[model samples]
Target chain A: MARVDRSLVTHLPLFAGVKPDDLEEILREARSARYPKNSAIFEQGADAQSFFLLLHGHVRAAKTTPTGEQIVVRYVAPGETFGLATAIGLAHYPATATAVDDSIVLIWPTAAWPRLAERFPSLAANTLQTVGARLQESHTRILEMSTQQVEQRVAHALLRLAKQSGKKLDQGIEIDFPISRQDIAQMTGTTLHTVSRILSGWESQGLVESGRQRIILREPHRIVVLAERSADSGAA
Target chain B: MARVDRSLVTHLPLFAGVKPDDLEEILREARSARYPKNSAIFEQGADAQSFFLLLHGHVRAAKTTPTGEQIVVRYVAPGETFGLATAIGLAHYPATATAVDDSIVLIWPTAAWPRLAERFPSLAANTLQTVGARLQESHTRILEMSTQQVEQRVAHALLRLAKQSGKKLDQGIEIDFPISRQDIAQMTGTTLHTVSRILSGWESQGLVESGRQRIILREPHRIVVLAERSADSGAA
Candidate 1:
């Protein structure tokens, strides 16, 4: 197990009220594990055994259907927690957590939860806040997917990703992580062919530029308008 | 304020292990309020100042787009909590909470959360569990919306609602509340015209019987099969 920086624990919302000694104790029992790009940190239906705190890199949370279809639920940023199936009493994970890039995570056995929550009440409180916000966001996305057209849904997905992990570039802003059309298709709940067609249309308009899974958003404002334009669409 | 049965507090997942004095204090401060049929209990973008526990009747949580189109997020049931905007630090409510029928709720100011959590850690833990489950369900719905066909999505929505609040009758299982085709359309992210067309087809097939805000599943198993079937459809 690799030791974590003491300062890192002090800054995390989940550890807001955790004392120095308790934090040290937790770090002592925790394991810092690394994963290569495109590998799964945890797979759906696997044993839900641990909770992870991302130390570095991005991960995509996805769920798959019986028909072998997939959808990206959300992406994880550094300092965020993931793989929390046990928090809701699930015996197995309901989704897969795959590393988008080479990543590091601090792992703790599920057994640590009860002691930790009782010792630091803020831990449970912070967890409630995080889960509540994610629930709200998921609900918002459902409404968006239900009411918005494919074009609007794709634009909104890219915009959300850009806001979370965008990097400034000369062309405009890049998504920062290596993601493909298939990944975008999964995120927006459309086929890769459709995403390709939409991206091609946007490329001709100088709105975006893409090559080999790397994309740069040349114009975000126009995309925002496209995301909100709903009159002619047959969506609810 | 209308007083609640003490047994109700004793059985709630959120109140487990709370001391009798603390439970009594919380109940004493809580107000049981009634909402008339079709009236909004809380509207979107309003102040996020209160938390509610549904005591009786149903509610529809929905969000609207800038174009004035709306979609239902989820239906709230009795013995559940809603109006949790402040639970995640949002200053304004992100969605509207309207009574589907006349309803009653136990209302508590948001200020009570911290004190309640401090006195009863289980309160926060239970909140975490509730939020976590809702988050998981929302993620599942997003995946279904992204990867499933309109028929499949609609089927799944009704099945979920029925499972949550269905009442058995001689002909079939009736959804235990009033809900419209427009509401189902909103939940599934389709137009009412499409919903009507599909429901008409199903009615002919004896799969469902719906009219005037009432619906009974004549053949739930067939709908489940339809929901789980995925090929040859415009979905992920």
Candidate 2:
């Protein structure tokens, strides 16, 4: 069992409002581990033996469709929880979680949930809050895909990524991760060619800078305007 | 403070493990109300003062995008819960919910959430399960939209509705509600014209029976095949 420092998770949302002693007890049930970059922590349809809280680095959660095409579900940031299939009543993980960078996570066996939840009610409450927020985000993504144009959806996807993990730089806000155009295409539900063309057009218009797997938003406000452009104005 | 029968909620997924007396006590904190057909139960962005469980009727939850286009988020069936902004930590409702039929719902003020959640941990657990299931469904929808053709998407949408509220009959399984093509179009992220043309083709093929505000799947198995058709085979 890896030793966990109380300070490592004192500021995280999952531990919000928890008493110090209870926090220690909760941490006792969790085992911490490291995952290398690009390693899958869990795969879709695998038995969900444990749930995790990311203590460091980023993770990508993705789903493979019946036709074998991959869809980027969402990216998990530090301090967020993932692999919660058991909490949601699923026997297996619905999507795969891969470490986007060398990451540390605190894993708790699913069996401990009932006892822990019984002893510390806040655990259930916090998990509910986390799941609720994700549910709302999923609804928003569905709405965007249903109503918005491809470019608008792509813009929204980038903005969401920037908000989640962007770093302020001298030039502009960088997405703070090595993300390829193919990843953007998967996230936006478009083809690689279409995503490349759209990013190229944005580059010429001075809205963004992109190369290889790096992206920097030169004019995020402009991207927002483009994302919110009305259907009439957005029509080709 | 309208009367709420305990049996009306005992079988619900939200109250699955709640004890009978505890259920009664929970019901005591709630009020029941009726919403007329096509009435707005709650509007999007409204102050979310209450959460509810439908006792008898269907509700449509929708989100209006920034550009003023409405996207059908999901439909709430009888015995299901909705309007839980507080549990998710939102001060305002994210979407508008409207009655599709004469409906009765047990209403609980948002202020009671913490108390109820503390008193009954199953409530929180069940709600987490509900939200998680919806999130999974949303991911499935995203995958479909990202990879499938419009026809396949439409097929999947209809099949989903049929599974949710289908009424088996001699001819076929009816959708059991007044859902128009425009609603289906909005649900599947396509234009009305495209939805109409596709449905017409399906009608001609004897795969479905669709009229003004009704749809019946004459050949559900065939529709499933179409919905699962690989992209290479579904291309026009």
TM-score of candidate 1 against the unseen true structure: 0.94
* Residues A6-51, model 1: lDDT tens digits: 7866788877777788788878878888999999899999998898
Predicted candidate 1 versus true structure: per-residue lDDT over B1-236, tens digit per residue: 66677786677877776777777887987888899889998889999889899988999898987778898878999889988877776778888999988998999998877887766777777777888888888888888788767888889999999999998888889998899889999988888888889899899989999999999999999888888776474422
After superposing the true interface residues, what Cα RMSD does each candidate give? 1.3, 1.0
- N/CA/C clash count, model 2: 0
Regions of model 2 farther than 4 Å from truth: A232-236, B234-236
Tens-digit lDDT track for model 2 on A1-236?
Answer: 66699888888888787899999989998999999999999999999999999988889999997558999988999889999999889989999999988999999998888777767778888888888898888888888888777899999999999999999888788998788888999998998899999999999989999998899999999999898886678423
